[model samples]
Target: MNIVACVKQVPDTEAQIKVKPDGSGIEEGGIKWVMNPYDEFGVEEALRLKEKNGGEVTIVCVGPARAMETIRTALAMGADKGIHISDPAFDGADAYTTASALAAAIKGIPHDIVFCGQRAIDDDSAQVGAVLAELLEIPQVTVVTKLEFAGNSVKVIRPIEGAQLLIECPFPCVVTAQKGLNEPRYASLPGIMKAKKKPVDVKDAGALGVSTDRKARVVRFVPPPARAAGKIICADDTPEGKAAELAKLLREEAKVI
Candidate 1:
């Protein structure tokens, strides 16, 4: 079983993020980068699969040079090798373009199963894995919380609003892992040292033969407006009067009634 796990680099959730004054993107100067949390679940699942089936787990990533750090992070957690897809042409790429590059790399490799996070925490698009599956012409299961392996097929459980759906798909399929899939393991000291020696094949868009055309693009990024201070309703002496004042404020000032 040759398992391919796709990972992405994203800013730490706790990092202080500030938008560029030009409304272009976030300020990356002091941001701490890490592997996307959901993607970590995918990597952990891949490692578990490799452990059970006795095969190699390859980490595939699409990002700039800094993304190699994330790939090595996966390696430290027991992935065998990594493929880093990086290029200037891929800058500002949309989900379609991103998935295209991933599909191109996967096409050249032996992949019996492919795993990806349900969505990248940065963009929250939740489209790359499904798009990659479509480009590969293989079956795909998204938002998967549980997985079970059979002879040549895999069963997955995905949750809906109030119920869960159990789906079965064959090998050579794509699965987007959800949060409940599994707990991610931290890399040991020995594993961290070994990861530094692991081989990572860096490929460009041209090398992958993927087009740079973007089906969608982010024109601009604007920071959310600063929240306003809450108003105190202490003007009214009675509780009923305070409730009436609150309703009036909601209907007039807040306009949320």
Candidate 2:
């Protein structure tokens, strides 16, 4: 089995993010970057599959030069190598353009299965995996929580609104991993040392023969509005007094009851 895991570098979830003054994007100077959290599940799933099936696992990413750190992190987690799609032209590209480039790069490599995160935290668009599958002309199962291999096919379970959907797809397919897929493993000291020497192939849009024209553009970014403070009801010590005050507040202020 030859498994390819698509990973991305994104702002750390807990980091305090600030929008740039120009309203173009976030302030990146002081922000901490890490591998996209959801992509960790995809990498871990790929590693596990390789361990069980006796094959190689490759990590692929598309980003600026800083993204090499993200790729090395996956290498430390046991991916055999990495492919980085890096170019200034790809800087402001949208999800479709990114998927097109990634699909083109993957075409140059041998792969039986492709894995990706359900979504990128930064954009939260959740469109790349499905779009990549379309570009590759392969079957795709998104938000997969469980996966099992059988002969030449793979069975997967994905979450719906209130239940899980079971799906079976053949090899040369794409799978976008969800939160419950598996717990990602940390890199050991030896693994980290070995990762420093692993091969990471860097390519650009032209190298992949993909256009960088963005179909979608971000006009501006607005931060969410601040939350309002909650109201507290203080009545006399009696339970009835408190109950009556709460009732009045709910009826007049909250208006939910």
Candidate 3:
């Protein structure tokens, strides 16, 4: 099955994110990082595919040195090895640049199937898998909920607005996993220990021979405005009066009506 799963490290969903005063980026200090939830499904699916077809699963990630933890997390979950792309040039890189780095790394490996999350939690840009597929000149299927092997090809189910589409794609294809795909397994004690010794090939932008030019960049990151406090309508003397007052407030002050 020679599967390749692309993953990312992101701030925990429960973590309180603070934007920098300069609006360049968020404050990394005191922030807890974890593997993207959507990518976990892709890793789980890759592990399952390897267990069934008898091959290895490789994890590919692009981030700073801290991202090695995310690759190790996937390794602890049963991936065979990892490729960590860490370089200063990739800082604040857009989806196209990130996908370019991933494609460069995967180009040197044996991959029959490439798995990625439908969208990264940090960026929420569901473009990497498709971009990588295009760069690799291979087919792609996005937001896949269910997948089944069919000899040299695979069948996948993708949900739309109100309906679903069943697609059959050949080998050497990219698949973006959706939430309903599968449940991710926790790393066991033995797996965790083994992951510490697993091989991880670290590469830089130069090693991958990828250009640093970005298709787009984040100019600034601004925090949302604070919410206003709620108002009470306790001045009304009776229930009917309160109702009338509320209506008046809605229609005049709030102007919602």
Candidates in descending lDDT order: 3, 1, 2
Report lDDT (Cα) of residue 112, candidate 2: 93
Tell me the spans in candidate 2 whose CA falls farther than 4 Å from its real position.
Answer: 236-248
Quote model 3's TM-score. 0.91
Candidate 3 stretches greater than 4 Å from native: 232-257
Q: How many clashes (backbone atoms < 3 Å, residues ≥3 apart in a chain or on different chains) does model 1 have? A: 0
Model 1: worst 10 consecutive residues (lDDT sum):
228-237
Give the winner by TM-score: 1 or 2: 2
Task: State, as a TM-score between 0 and 1, how close model 1 is to the true structure.
Answer: 0.91
Q: For model 1, what is the error of residue 171's alpha carbon versus the real structure, in angstroms, after optimal superposition?
A: 1.1
Whole-structure CA lDDT of model 2: 0.94
Predicted candidate 2 versus true structure: per-residue lDDT over 18-110, tens digit per residue: 888888888888789999999999999999999999899999999999999999999999999999999999887799999999999899899
- The parts of candidate 1 lying over 4 Å away from their true place are 233-257
Winner by TM-score between candidate 3 and candidate 2:
2
Whole-model lDDT, candidate 3? 0.94
Task: Return the candidate ranking by TM-score, descending.
Answer: 2, 1, 3
Query: Which candidate gets the maximum TM-score versus the true structure?
Result: 2
